[model samples]
Structure formats: structure tokens, C-alpha cells
Target: MATATLISTISTNLRQPTATFQPKTPLLFRRRQVVAFESKPWESQEKVLRENAFVCAASRRNSNSSSSITVTDVSVSELDDKLRKVLQFVLWAAEGVYIIWLFLLPYAPGDPVWAISSDTINSLIGLSLNFFFLLPLANSVGIHLLDAPVLHPMSEGLFNFVIGWTFMFAPLLFTDRKRDRYKGSLDVLWGFQMFLTNTFLIPYMAIRLNKPDTKYTPRKDSQLGSVMVNGASVVGVIGGAACLISILWGLFGRSDSDFGSVADRWEFVVSYLGSERLAYAFIWDICLYIVFQPWLIGENLENVEKGKVNIVKYLRFVPVFGLVAYLLCLDVDEEV
Candidate 1:
């Protein structure tokens, strides 16, 4: 009996300890599972935060791109507008200076319009007759259509040289895409230009800068315009050849007369330009023509034949010949 009681007490003690520890172990395990569940939610929350950040960054990039494009477009438009205004101002200013320097200034070389001399008048008549040798060549060949005036070869050559260049501009002016912008009669303007030269042309240059009229109808090409446009190649060759000949003629013409050597003729020309108003004015016209020729041709490169556009585009930077070449390569079939 003593042995059985002792064994039972030992077993009771061991069972009591196991029951107490098992309940506490299960409670600790449950607390650890709660911590694991909480950590899983934190991982999902972190993933959501990263996704939102990516979306916000992408939206910002698109917004910045659109804003930059808008800014670039606005800037280009503003720059173009400013440039046009500046060009208009410069053209008008040139006109003012041209009138003042050539006509109004008494101190300028040669006679003012109000006080032109008879010798100057005689020189003008001779130079005009010498142009294309319309009268002089006829007289020389014994046709005797009109009596040609006699003047220094230098004066004759210079006058015709300028006129030749002026003639080529007819095709350019008529074919200008913006020609309809001018409201005046082109016939009258060009007629005046043939005699008056830049006195009329400068104003036309400035006036052509007027903003396009949306409601205005473009006019049909005039009869003169048609002639010039159709015969552009012939005009180019004739004008270009005339210009080349004029230079040579200035240096060597009137060989039978007492004009002296080329060096001496060159010296006389230098003095004439400094002392004669017409000669001085011609210098101004030539300078202005240099600028205007490239300006006009470069703007109208589209009028050139397709295969010849690159040729004319580069040649526009050249002086008188550049314009001549442009005329020779004009696309006659294209509408002005």
C-alpha cells in the first residue's frame, strides 16, 4: 500500500506541471501569429506607397513635357513676330534716309533735282540712247532712227549697266508670291521705276511688307507681268550679257576716241562718282540692289524649277548674275 501511494503522488506532480506550461505556450504562439499578420499588412501598405509614388512621378513627367512644348511654341511665335516688326522698321528707315541723302541734301555730290545742269541732261540723254544701243547702234549701222547723244564711255556704260540689272527685276517683281499685296498699279510703278529706279522701288519694298489681307482677292497677272514671266529666260540672258558688256565697255569703249588708257578711265570714274550726284546716286542704287536681290530671290526659291532649286538657292547670294540665273531657272508652268 505504501509503495502505491508514493508512485501516485509523483505522477500527480508531473501532470500538474505539464498542464500549466501547455496553456502558457499556446498563448505565446497566438501572440507570435498576431505579430506575423500585422507585418504582412505593413508589406502591402509599403507596396501601395511605391505604386502611388511611381504614378505621381509619371504624371509629373507628362505635365512637364506638355508645358515645355507649349513654352517652345509660344517663344517661336513671339520671336517671329518681333523679327517681322524689326524688318519693317528698318525698311521704312532706309526709305527716309534714301530721300534725305539723295534728293534733299544740297551738299551731296552732283546737282539736286531743282538745280540739274544742262550737261547732266545731255549725259542722261546720251546714256539712255546708249542702252542696248537702241539708238546709237542704229545710227552706227546707218539706220539713223534717232540722233544718239555723245558722252564719256564711263557714263554711258554705268547708266546702261544699272538699267540692265533693273530690267531683270521685272520678272522677279511680277512673279513675287506677295506681289498682290501692293494695291497700286504695277504698270505705273514699274514704268516709273524704269526711269526713276529706286526712287519707286524702295517704297514698293516697304509697302510689300503689309500684313496679308484675308478677305482680299488676288488679282490676275497683268499683261506686262505675263510678258516678263513668260520671257524670263530671255530677259535674264539679255540683262546678264548687257551687264557684262557694260563693264568691259566702261573700261575700253570709244577706242577710236581720246578716252586714254584703262587706268586713266578708272581714275576719271572715281572723280566722277565723288563729284557727280547722278553717279553718287547710282552707287547707292547698286548697294541697295545687292541687298534686295538676295532678299527677293531667297524668299522666292519655291518659284524655281524643282531640279534647279538648290542651284538658285545658293546663287541668290551672288550679285546680279544670281538674279539672272534665278530668272533663267524660273518654273514658268507654276502659278505665281
Candidate 2:
């Protein structure tokens, strides 16, 4: 009885030990999971920062290259921007002056931009065509716009070929800047939008052949991406050729009426002085427009006395509006 009492007393005094602890396995696993989750993003952030630093350094190295003489030093992007701004400003200002003068020709101050008469817009339609075709040829006849010097008796005729090319080339410029207000553009929707990557060929040539046979491709992609790019490139070339051909056809396919001689004929003088017939004005406009091409080209040509005028790009269109007006006149002639 004494022994049994003593054992019972010991058991009661010591409560059973509960399962309370682990070997720290779960805690270790949780810590490892958190580190792994954070590592990938951290590595990515580091890579981005390093890349940005490299670019920043390269740009700084190139920023002042034009001041010195070196092949790689022209600061190409900056030069292009400067040219663009200058061009845009010149174009807008000239257009604005001409439009205003045309709107209020009779009362406007001293001969505002070619004495633009306040003719109705309706009269101006189709007039642009004349500038596109005849002016170049008339220029061939020695009546250069602004009465510019006739390089030769046949200068105007010789100029016709260049003007034809410019007119036929109308399509690509339209596509490149579709928002631009030119006619015959909407009809070409979904007609295999050209890549004009061939135009980039000029830049590539500038970099490659200009250099020691170095190439112009930027970083290459994966094999699949490369294949896709090459395919798109080929398609671009074909589409550009098609567009060029179509535009060329329009300029070259002049009617007998187009190539007809107008000087000294009653039809010519009557067409010039008569009522606001769309056709006559259109023909005259084309003549004057092409007449003006050389003048505008001169404006773009660089001179030491004048600063560079890269912005002089497409200023040829300032006179083109006059040509379009002529085409509108033709529509009237057809109607009567």
C-alpha cells in the first residue's frame, strides 16, 4: 500500500510532457522560399540600371562630335531634328502667307506670295494637275519659275523628265504621311501598305558602303524573328515597286489634250482670260507649278552664306497646290 501510494504521488506531481517542438525544418523552408521569390526581380532591376548607364555614357560621348572632324562624329539624330524643325517652320509660314494672299488677293498688301487671287475653291480643283505635267515641260521651254536663268535652250524640256519622276513618286509620300491632305490616297486602302524599307537602303548605304563594308542591321533577333523580318522586308520591296510604277503611269499617261501646244492659239489666250473655267486655270497652274520647282529646289540647296535648310524638304508642294487647282478646271472642261 505504501509503495502504491508513493508511485501515484510521483505520477500526479509530473504531468505528461506534450509534443511542443520541431527541428526548425519548416522555418528554414519558409526563409528559402522568400529569398527565391525576391531574387529574380532584383536581378532584373540590376540589369536595367546597368543598361541605362551604358546608354547614358554612349550618348554623352557622341553629343559633341560635330565640333571636331571624325567619321562617326556628326550627331546624326540631332542633325536630323534640327533640319526637320527648320523645314517645318519654313513650310508652314510659306503656306500660311500664300493661303492668306490667295484668299484676299485684290486688297492684300504688295503682291503677297505670287499675287494669289481670291479665286473660289471650286475653281481650284484639278488645277494641280497642270503644275504636275506642263510646268516642267514649259520649264523645258525656258520659262523657269521666278525667271530663273535658263541653263540651256532645252533646259525646260530636260526638266520634264525630273518633274515626271517627282509626280509619279507621289504615292509613297502619301502613304508615309497619310494624314497629309493629298488626293487619290483613300482609293489605295489595304493595297499592301509598303514597308519602304528600300528607302532605308539609303541610310544603310550611308553607313555601310560609306564605311569599310560594315553592315547597318541593328541587333538581330531570334531565328524566327529574323525570318519574319526578312519576309516583311521582301514584301516591302515588292510593294514599293508597285506603288512607284502606278504613280509613274499616272504622270506618263497624258492625253493628246495634255501634250497639245497652247501658245498663241485663241484657245490658249481665251483659256487664260476667260470666265472661271476649271480646265484653263488647271493647265496654267501646272505650268507655273513646274516652273517653280527649280526655284524651290534652289531654296533647299545648301549655301555657305545661308545656314543649312534640311527643312527645305517637300517645300516643292508649296507650288503643287497651284497645280492641283488646274486639274479641277479639266473636270469642268469635260462637263461642258
Candidate 3:
């Protein structure tokens, strides 16, 4: 009976479906098995950490580059400001001294401002007549409109030469980018400058150096400015021709005037500067022009045509002819 019972149990076990059977296990062991089958989190976390480190390094580099650029810009601005201040101070000082020494001081090599000499007046009249001299040249050719005063050609030539060169500066001043920095009318200033020369120009130079303000609006150009800017080439030609003619006239002009040889004319010029206040003041104007010509030209080089900029830049240091060349080479189409 027991053997028959055993056989029945085995048959019962074999008859059940194989899918119905399951083995029991400890809970801890089952938890460990499930954990083992999952994907690794540490590798992914490491990749994410590396990516973040790279981003931070790149940001730091960019910040460093920006900081360096900012420092460079600040330094350049400071240097320019310092230079502007120095130039303004020097120009103002020059103006004060120029007024005192030329106009007020009795110690200078010419007559004082309070006194007037008939000989000086006569010389002034002669120089003025010699400037255009339509009647004088006509008189020289026997078609006299009036009597022409006879004078030393060297003195006349030197005076007109300086004046003619100064005439060209009118256009240059009108077209300057910094012209608006001046509060006064350019027309009056330039007009006076023709007679007084540096007395007006030096003040304008110093005034223009003032820092531009937000309240300032650019003024429309005056009729004089328009004429000068438009006729710059004509002005250049006239001024340049005048200068050339002045030199030639000094050396060989007025053949009938009994002026001595070139050596004698040169001697007269040397003595004339020492003896006449007007002539002595002209010497001061010439020196100032030499310094100012390059300064104004260098600043306005952008107004020159592209092809001629390099040439104008180098020639600017030259005195009278340099200004002539610039006016001739101006880009007239450019707005002043």
C-alpha cells in the first residue's frame, strides 16, 4: 500500500504543468539580483560632471579676455584725455604771451601800441598797394590810374605772402570736425583772423579743445563757410600763386623801383623785421602757422581723398605750400 501511495504522488507531480512550479528565495538575495540587472549610474554621472567642468573653463577664459580688453580701452582713453588737456593749457598760455609781447610791451623791437609813426603808416600803405597792384602794374606799364607808392619789394612780398597763406586757413577751419566745439560765429572769427592772424586763431584753437557737451547742437554753416568750402580749390590756387609770386617779386619784381640786388633785398628784410612792429608781428604769425598747419592738417586728413591722404600727411609739416597742396587735394563732395 505504501509503495502504491508513493507511485501515485510521483504521477501527481509529473501530471502538473512545468510552468506552474516556482522556487522560494530569501528577500535580501532577491533584492540583490534585481539591483545587479540595472544599468550603471556612476558612468553617466561622471560624463555629466566632465561636461560641466569644460563649460566652466570656457566661461572663465571668455571673462578673462573681456577683462583684458576693457583694461586696454580704458588706458587708451586716459592717454588721449591727458594729451588733450596738455595741448589746451599750452595754447592758452601762448595766446596770453602773444598778446602781451606783440601788442602791449614797449620793450619789443617795434613801436609801442600807443604810438604811431608816419613812416610806418607810409610803409603799410605801400605794402597794401603792392598786394593786388592792378594800378601799380598798370602804372609800371604806363597806364596809370593813380600814383603808385615805391617801396622795398622784399618787405611787401613777405607781408603779402604770409597774408595769402593765412587766407587759405579759412577753408580749413570751416571744414574742421571740431569746428562746432567753438560757440562763436566762425564768420566773424575768420574775418578778424585775416587782419589780426593768431590773435583770433589761437583763442579758437584753445576753445575748440573743450569737452563736447550733450546740450550742444551742430550749427548750420554760414554763407562764408559755404563759400570757403565750395571755393577751396580756387582759394588754394590764389594763395599758392600769391606765395610764389611774392617770392619772385621779392627777388626781381619792380625792376624800375631802384630796389637793390637779391643780397640787398635780403638785408632789408632782416632789418625790416627788427625795425617795424607790423613786420615783427608777422614773424610771430609765421612761426605759429608752422606749428598749427600740421596740427590742423593731421586732424583733418580724413577729409582728403583716399588716394592723396598719405601725400597730404607727409607734406603737412611743410609751411605754406603744404596748406596749398591740402586745399587743392580736398574731397569737396564730403560734407563739412
The number of the candidate with the highest TM-score is 1
Task: RMSD for all candidates, in order, please.
Answer: 14.3, 22.9, 15.5
lDDT (Cα, 0-100) at 75 in candidate 2: 72
TM-score of 2: 0.24
* Span of ten consecutive residues with least summed lDDT in model 2: 327-336
Write out the backbone clash pairs for model 3.
none
- What is the alpha-carbon lDDT of model 1 when measured against the actual structure? 0.84
Instruction: Show pairs that collide, candidate 1.
Output: 109-277, 110-277
RMSD of 3: 15.5
Better of 1 and 3 by TM-score: 1
At residue 139, candidate 2 shows an lDDT of 56
Candidate 3 regions with alpha-carbon error over 4 angstroms: 1-72, 141-143
- Cα deviation of 61, candidate 1, in Å: 7.9
lDDT of 1 by residue, 100-164 (tens): 88887888998888888998887877787687657766776898767877677888788888889
lDDT of prediction 2: 0.35
Which regions in candidate 1 have their CA more than 4 angstroms from the true location? 1-71
